[model samples]
Target: MNENAESLSRRLIRNFNTAPTTHDVREPLYDSIGARLAPGTAAQKLGASIDTVAPGKMSCPYHFHYAQEEMFIILEGSGTLRVAGEMLPLRSGDVVFIPPGPEYPHQIVNTSDQPLKYLSVSTREQPEVCEYPDSGKFLAMASAGGERVFDVVQRRSNDLDYWDGEP
Candidate 1:
């Protein structure tokens, strides 16, 4: 097969079960496999991924985005959607919409004995800021050319004055 033939065949089509894994987190509280699906296609303004979280784990901390909105489509198993200090039960076929801002800080907790799988979609907003309430930290990230150029995480208590470095 020609080089272009193989590339074109897989560019626009993908199965979540067989998608290429982009990230696998096995931290103490986080255990998940993220399969990025949008990067394989021509999508520029949106991002999509399928994440499978192991039982009794979560994919990320309770955080809220400042610029990008997100949606989650539960595909298999059951979990708990922890949002804004509330614990909401989640099951297969559940659709969740999270708007940007601290008012909707959220995280997925796999409360089931089986792996919880969901399709996560979000706006590809640059120079995004995410605040983690539980950790008292925040993340600032920026990307260019489909690559991350800047990513920083700092605690809220360590913030500097606007003119700290100014003459």
Candidate 2:
């Protein structure tokens, strides 16, 4: 460890509610404040974050990963979980597990009048592919040494044959 690195005890402990947040907003209904909790910790195979979504907003789109699995524990307020085309009610103390693949495309919408908060944890798998079923889009990402190497999102209609343009 570096001389200035945080001690083991400090690194292992994190407070989701008080952690600094990053705003993630995209037009109409996608808006949330996220506090990442795994970057400087000793954890090497998992990632975690605290996400807060305002009423009537969604933190992210309906998508599923090909290599990583995720779980969310609702910490505050209520919402609606849109999973596999079904809307399930979500409230504080609810724990939701989402497996990777096309069958479990999911998203959370804050339908209540108060802000919804949740702790999200997922496997840190590299070179992962995620599909957005609602928009017919997909994302391929690869990272090296904690840095992104390649990232691209495209529609399925843009795919080409394996031998296309090959000599």
**Each candidate's TM vs. the true structure?**
0.90, 0.92
**lDDT of model 1 at position 53:** 94
CA lDDT of each candidate?
A: 0.92, 0.92
Q: Which stretches of candidate 2 lie over 4 Å from their true place?
A: 1-6
Every candidate's CA RMSD: 2.1, 2.4
Q: At residue 108, what lDDT does model 2 achieve?
A: 94
Collision pairs in model 2: none
lDDT of 1: 0.92
Candidate 2: worst-modelled 10 consecutive residues by lDDT: 1-10
Candidate 1 per-residue C-alpha lDDT over 84-159 given as tens digits, one digit per residue, 9 for 90 to 100:
9999999999999999998999999999999999999999999899999988999999998888999999998998
Candidate 1 stretches with Cα past 4 Å from truth are 1-10
**Worst 10-residue stretch by lDDT in candidate 1?**
19-28
- Give the top-scoring candidate (TM-score): 2
lDDT of model number 2: 0.92
